[model samples]
Structure formats: C-alpha cells, structure tokens
Target chain A: MRGLEKLVTGRLEGVEHGSGVGMDALTQYRNSVKERLDSADVLVAKLVHENTVLSQTVETRTQEVENVRHQLKTLQNRVAELEGREARQEEEIEIVKDLFEHLCGVRVHKSYEDDTGLWFDASQGSRNGIMDYKLGFVKNESSAGTEVVYVPLLKQRSSDELRALQKQLPGYMFDTLSFPLKSLYQFYSKMARSLSKKIE
Target chain B: MRGLEKLVTGRLEGVEHGSGVGMDALTQYRNSVKERLDSADVLVAKLVHENTVLSQTVETRTQEVENVRHQLKTLQNRVAELEGREARQEEEIEIVKDLFEHLCGVRVHKSYEDDTGLWFDASQGSRNGIMDYKLGFVKNESSAGTEVVYVPLLKQRSSDELRALQKQLPGYMFDTLSFPLKSLYQFYSKMARSLSKKIE
Candidate 1:
C-alpha cells in the first residue's frame, strides 16, 4: 500500500497526477491516493500513542492524590488525640491545685511574702519598720500535706499588743516565742493542732 | 484527490469491481476512492477529540495531587504545634504540683487520710472503740489554701494513756476538752501556736 499509489498515477502524490493517455493517467492518480491513506494511518497511530501517555498520567496522579488523602486522615486523628489528652491534663492540674490550696495554700491578704511565711499579714500596716511578726512553715517533701503557715514583717510588738491580738482572735494563736528554734517548733505544733475541731 | 484512486483502475472498492467499459468505470472508481478519503478524515477528527479529552483529564488529576499535597503539609504543621503546646502544659502542671507538695501537701505517713484530716495518725492503732482524737477542717472554697486537716478512729484510752502521750511528745497537745466546744477553741488555739520555727 505504501508505494502502490505511485504506480497507477504518473505525476507523484506518491507519483502525482500525470498527463498520460487514458489508463496510465488513472493509474497514476490511484497511486497518489494510496499514499494519502498511508499518511493517514501514521497520523492515527500517533494520536493513539498520545492517548496512551495521557491515560498513564491520569492514573499516576490519581494514585498520588489517594496517598496524600490517607496521610491527611492519619494526621487528623493524631490532632484529635492530642487535643483530648491536653484537655484532660489541664483539668487534672486544676483539680490538684484546688486540693493544694485547701490543704495549706491559704494566703495572707496583706502579707503574702513567700510560700513558707507571712510577714505582718495579720497586723495592720506597720510599714517602714519591722513591727509585724512572721509566721511560716515547711513541708516534709513534695508539699501535699498539713503544716502551719504563718508570716510577718518589721518592728516588735509590745506585750500589750500581743495580749490585745490574743484577746481579739481568741482561737487564733499569736505567740512570740518562735525566735529561738525550740519555741518555733512548739509554735508550729500548736498552730497545726489549733485549726481542728471535733467532727461531731 | 479523494476520488482519483477509484478512476483508472475502476473495480469499485467503494462501489465493487465492475466490468464496465472505459470512462464510466473510471468515474465510478474515483467516486468510491473519494468516499474512502472522507472517512479517513472523519476518523482523524475523532482521534483528535479523544486526545483532547485525555489531556484535560491529565491536567485535572495533576491539579488534584498538588492540592492534596498542600493540605497534608498544613496538617503536619498543626500536629507539630499541638504537640509543643501539650508538652509545655504538662511541664507546668508538674511544677505547680511540686510547689503544692512542699507547701502543705504532706501526708501523715501512718495518718494517710483524706484531703483535710489526720485522726489517730499520730496516735497508735486504737482501731476498735472511741479512742483516737479527730482533727479536720474545711477549705474556704475551692481548696487551694492553708487549712488544717485531721481524722480519727475508735477506742478511748484511760487518763493514764493521755498523760503518757502528753509527756512523750511534749509539744503534742492531748486534751479531752474539745467535746465541750468552749474548751475546743482553747485547745485549737493551743495547738496552732506550737508548730512554728524562727528563720534565724
């Protein structure tokens, strides 16, 4: 079929249209027609080839999309898990803190000095001088227990002032003997026990 | 050009080979050849259209892959951020808990009781009848403060046992007056002042 068109036709398409006598001219024309058919075949083959390549591309990209989607799903699950864990942890922290506060976390209104002591917290402003007494305590270790907490700051109070306070807050202890370590122990022991009452 | 093939060698590929004489046969052959060429043209057009569709599909799929990849990256970053936050929050919870422990979270080793009391914790196991003293206190509100906590059990001991304990732990107070309420206040006042120590 490739060169058949050139045979029948004299003037080349393969052998184009010729000015020959009757039969010869017809043959020449026929040959050229065959050539065109051959070319068309080739064109069709190329198009089919291109189609194959395009199909492959679509397949590959579709797979890639699926893989990425799977990855996204896994990440989403992880985020959900972490959010749950964080929320629970935060809540637990708050609960423990609450318990700690009740145990001995009570802070002095005006005398919030440190974790262990309260200086001049009870007495009114004796500012500029060491007039107020200090009250404080320490825990055995981690800090989830019962121990007296007290503090003070500036100036010494006269026996009169001490007696007055003792009279005012009868149940509240305001002893001044803690300066000497021995008295301090005695004061702590006393403080711890004073806050209790019969369950009945 | 299309009908040329059918002319000279007229056999009627489009019309069937005929035993006609000269010109008429050639004319008929040419016509059939033209028909074949037209069909070829139509086939090429169809192929081109199919190719275009394939190209469009490839482009769409490629874009989908890109979009999915972008989403995956964003999700990965979110996971990272959440992990960091959770880590920091967990660390903070631990620190606050440590501080609380040191403040007043101390538990009576043997006195291991509720959040607010240590009954026969200091006293030995009088675990049968009305014996050990009770000690407890409620927090002002949520529980993040300094308050005394105590508990107890049964079995009352004779006055002899009380006197013995008073001497053994000199600072530890042991009074049966709490039952009367008036003496209860006095006992508590006595108790709270005994646990403090001087900073010096």
Candidate 2:
C-alpha cells in the first residue's frame, strides 16, 4: 500500500507540469483528476463497441456491392437479347408490307406519300372474289348475299372505257363498296400514339 | 503540497482492495496501475473518434432509406397506370372478337387450340387473297395490260351458284378461299407474345 501511494504521488506530479498554478488550486486539481478517470473508463467501453459495429457495417457494404454487380450483368444480357429481336421483327414487317401491297392492290403505305408504286387511286374499293368488270371502273350493284367478289381498281380509266366495263359486267358490276381505310388508319394511329407515349 | 499527499494516499487506499498481506507485492500492483493510466488516455481519444464516425454513418443511412422510399412510390404509380391500361385493352379485345365472329362467320380462338373454332389452318388452301398463292389461280388476263384486283369472299354458295358466279366474273378465279380467321389469330398471338416477352 505504501508503494501504491508513492506511485499515485508520482502520477499526480506528472499531471502538475501543464497545470502549474491550476495544480496549486487543490480543489480544481482534484476535480480535474476525477473527471479524467471517469471519462477514460467510458471512452474505453465505447471505443470497443464502435469498432465492432464498424466491422459489421463494412462487411454488409461489400456484400451489397457484389449483389449490385451481379444484377448489372443480368440486365446487360437482357438488353442485348431484346435489341436482336427488335431488329428481326423490323425486317419481317418490311417483307410482309411489300407482299400485302403487291397482291391486294390495297397500296398499304406506312405514310401517305408512298402512293406512286401501286395502281390504286383517290377512291378506294375492295372485294373478296372473282370480278367481271374491267379495272378502274365504278358501278353500283346490289350484293347477291355472296360475301366474295372480285374488286378491280380502274386507274386513269376514261369515262368511255369505264361506261363500257360497267355496261358489260351487268350482275358482276363495278366496285362501289368502300374499303375500311378509316379502321386501319385508326389502328395504326393508335399504335403510333401508344409507341410515342411509351417513349415519353 | 499537504493536500496532494492526502489525495495520493486516498487513491492508493482504493487500490489496496486485494492487498491483505503487505508491501512485498506492492511493486506489481504499481506496474498494473501505470498500465491502466496510460491505456485510459489513449482510450479516451479513441472513443471520441469512434462516436463521431458512428453518428455520421447513422445520418447517411437515414437519408438512403428516405431516397429508396421515394423511388418505391414512383414505381408503384407506374404499375397502377399500366394495370389500368391493361384492363381497358382486355375489354376492347373481347369486343373485337365478337365483331370478327359476326362479320366473317368464323369463331376466333386462341392460337394454341387445334381444329376447333374459327382458327385459321394455313395447310388448308389459300382461300383468302392475303395468302401467298403459288399460281393455281389465274393472274392478269386483260388484253390491254396488267390490272390490280381485290377479290371478295363468296359466302355459303351452292356449286351451281358458284359456277354461275365464275362465268360472270373475269379476274382471277379460285375453287375456294378461306376466311381471315388466321390473320386475327396471328395478330392477337403476336401481341400476347410481345407483352409476355417484355414482362420476362
């Protein structure tokens, strides 16, 4: 106990260096020493806990980084696949469009400006079966309950040629039933609007 | 100085808890006392740093949680909008299906079913003008030049009526042409396939 008393005296002496006049104030010196001792105990315990929590946080962050990298790789692969499919579909649509224009004389155009290639004109007419009239002539005949009939588009036909074709055809007659151009136009317009909306 | 001596003695008294014998073991106790004092100084500084770092980390995590919550809200809104559009499209498709059945005398079914409903079978002859006919039907037969024709589908015609209709008409002739059940099936199938693919 005497040795411990001597040791404490030595520690107090060491603290006296910067304290100087403050150390001479006995009450102040005593209070300062007590504060330092109590603070040191709390500091040690708090440091140990913080170290543990920091290590756990670092581990969790590393795991999160790895998960994000894996997701990025998966998303990149999907984008490549989708781009390839979009290219293929665009090609198929072009081929189908050409076939439709050639066989149907419908002049299926992506835009209104593409009208020079086909034989159809300002007035549109369509039929579903064999026809007797010459091309590019207009006539009115009651539908005979037959759903299929030939529709011939008489492009640039003179009034005389049209009258002859109409007179000769009789029961078969020239086409006056209007094609459902409005329905098709609406469908495509809606499709375009929807696509634009998606882009936005 | 007198008070300092008293303070030192008081501290040593607290350390003398295990000293039942005498000053023979006091040197070891003094060494332990020195180590504890030195460790306390360092532990104090370390605790301040740890506390500062922990506080900063907690603030950052709170902000991140708030940002994630905002993003989730945006995603939920987008999902709700898409669900609404999907419901409307479903109703429109049902109405269109009814119209097609009434107008074409063919029942529309999902593409997967076989030999049932108004499903178009491509293997059956190319009855519609839409199909690619390899040359069984007559092509541009006018003496003047090639002409574009739209053929209508003949409905429920007897053999005699069909023969008489053929004599009256002049463009391409067909033994039979199928209704456009397959086209409608293809359109819906493509749409469903595209949407499903997008979801995946």
Candidate 3:
C-alpha cells in the first residue's frame, strides 16, 4: 500500500509538471501573437502617415503644374498679340521709308546705336551754296517730345539757311523741328520744293 | 491506498483538461494573429502599389511643369524680339507718312477694307480741262505684280490725259504702275512735278 501510494503521488506530480510546461508555452505563444499584432498596428500607422504626406505632396505638385500651365497659356497669348502688332508696324515702316527716299532723294538708314531713330545724309545744292543736311529722329522723355532734327553740315550757312527755311515753312517749328510724325511728309516736301527753287 | 490512487487520477485528469483549454486558446490567438498579419501584408502591398503609381504621377507632373516653364521662357523672348522690331517699324512708318503728305499736297486716309493699302483723292486743273486722280497701292501676290493704280474720275479726259501723262512720265510703266514700295515716293514725285508743269 505504501509503494502504491508513492507511485500514485509521483504520477500526479508528473502530470502537474507537464501541465505547467504546456501552460507556459501557450502563454508565451499568446504573447508573441500580441506583440506581432502591436507591430502590425505600428506599421499600418506609419504607412498611413507616409501615404497622407505623399498625397499632400502630390496635391501640391499638381497645383503647381496647373499654375505653370496657366502661365504658359497667358504668355502664348501675349506673344500672339505682339506678333500681330509687329506685322502692322512693319508694314507701316515700309511705306514711310518709301516716301522719304522718293521725296527727298535721301536714303534713310536705320541707326543701330539709337533705339528710336533713323539717319540720312543728303546734299542740297542751291544758287548760293550746297548745304549738307543730317536728318534724324531724337526721342525725348515726354510723350510728345520726339523731335525731327535737321542739322546742316555747313555751319556758316546753317544759321542763315535755317532761318530762311524756317521763315519759308511757317507751318513747321524750325529750331528743333519738333513736329508730329504724321506731318513729316509736308515738312520734307516743303524742304525739297524750296531747295529745288534755290538750286534752279 | 485506493483513496490516494483515486485522488491522483482526478488531479491528472484535471491537469489534462486545463492544458487542453490553454492549447485551444493559444491556437485561437495564433489564428487571429495570422489573419491580421495576412491582411496587413495585403494592405501594405496595395499601399506600395498606390504609392508607386502616385510617385510616377508626381514625377510626370513635375516634368510637365518644367516643360511648360521652358516654353514660357521661350515665348517671353519671342515677345521681346517682336516688340523691339515693332518699335523700329513704327518709327519708320511715321517718317514715311510725313514725306508722302508733304510731297503730294494731299491727305492719305488708311483703307481699313484693304489690309495693305492707302488712298488719296486730288483734282489737278489744266488749260485743257480738270482731271481727278485716285491714287493707291494695290497689293499683288508676285513681287512685280503690285501696282500703284491711278483711276481717273472723269472718263472724258481719261483716254487723252492718260496718254499724255504716260508720254510725259516715261520713267513710269504707265499701264499698271507696278512699282516696289521703295520706289513709290519717286513715282509720286514724278507724277506731281509733271502735273504741276502741265497746270502751269
């Protein structure tokens, strides 16, 4: 009886020991699962945050691109308008150059150094003397300040001829020749006619 | 001894039952963890794909914006060039218009209906009769085809005066007066001088 009691007690203790080991293993596994879940939560949170930032970045970039496109369109329109104006202005310039050459017998050359001017050198022979004229446009600061300058190369005759020419052509303001561009044809015609009469 | 054996057996059975319950809980927890991990993998893969596509979109958008900026810069340069040319052309036109008005002793009105033309009306009186002249530029497709048309208002003097004028101005090709824009001033000067002699 004593041996049988000892054997039964040993078996019971062994079973209890086995159960403790199994419970510990199960608890450890459960802890590992909980840890994995927590890590997944952290990863998901990090990924969501990163995605949100990326989305915001994309949105900003998209808006910037849109703005750039809009600006490009506006610039294109401006270029078109400028081109149209340029065409018309070019045609007008051609006509004006033609008239100057024919009426004054002067070849006008564009002044590269001057932004808003042209230059012509011509000799007008008269009974008294031959006068050399340097004609051009000079821009001033004011809106109507642009002047047509006629500088006689012959300094001696300049004063007398200029005075006479100014008197003969009463319509023109002689000292600086501050006349409108539209009336330039009339000024040149009078100059040509008066100069021709003197020469004849 | 019998009582001790029974007690040991009961303890062993209870331990076994508790271990089974613990193992079952562990399996359930592991399964839950596995499910969560699988879902997380799928979510991560989806997010990664979305991010990749979004990154590509952003890259493409960035490149497009850069292209637009380049275009805008190019267009701005074009506009500046056009503006410069326009300014020069405007100055030239102003000079030509002035010369035409002075030499012809007539006012030139811009013909809006004609894109490339101007018109003038004048009456010249002679001992024989009075003749009305309509002078203008007529654009032609070919270089030599463009002509300065002089239409007589009075049909009676048209035949005789046209012949006499043609004979008087031998330099001019009388039929069409097809002259270059540059030569227009010379042609008009000749016409005016001849007409003035005839009138005198």
lDDT of 3 by residue, B55-104 (tens): 88888888888898898889889888887877767665655454334434
TM-score of chain A of each: 0.44, 0.40, 0.51
Q: All predictions: root-mean-square deviation over Cα?
A: 12.2, 16.3, 13.5
Query: Candidate 2: what lDDT?
Result: 0.38
Q: Which of candidates 1 and 2 is the stronger one according to TM-score?
A: 1
Candidate topping DockQ: 1
Q: List candidate 2 stretches off by more than 4 Å.
A: A1-38, A102-107, A111-200, B1-38, B46-200
Q: Whose TM-score is higher: candidate 2's or candidate 3's?
A: 3
Local distance difference test, each candidate: 0.48, 0.38, 0.56
CAPRI-style class, candidate 3:
acceptable
List per-model TM-scores for chain B: 0.45, 0.40, 0.50
Tell me each candidate's TM-score: 0.50, 0.36, 0.53
Candidate number that wins on DockQ, 1 or 2? 1
True contacts kept of 2: 0.09
Per-residue CA lDDT of model 2 for A124-179, tens digit only, reads 22232112221121222454222221244566577764664454344323454432
Every model's DockQ, to 2 decimals? 0.28, 0.09, 0.27
Best by lDDT: 3
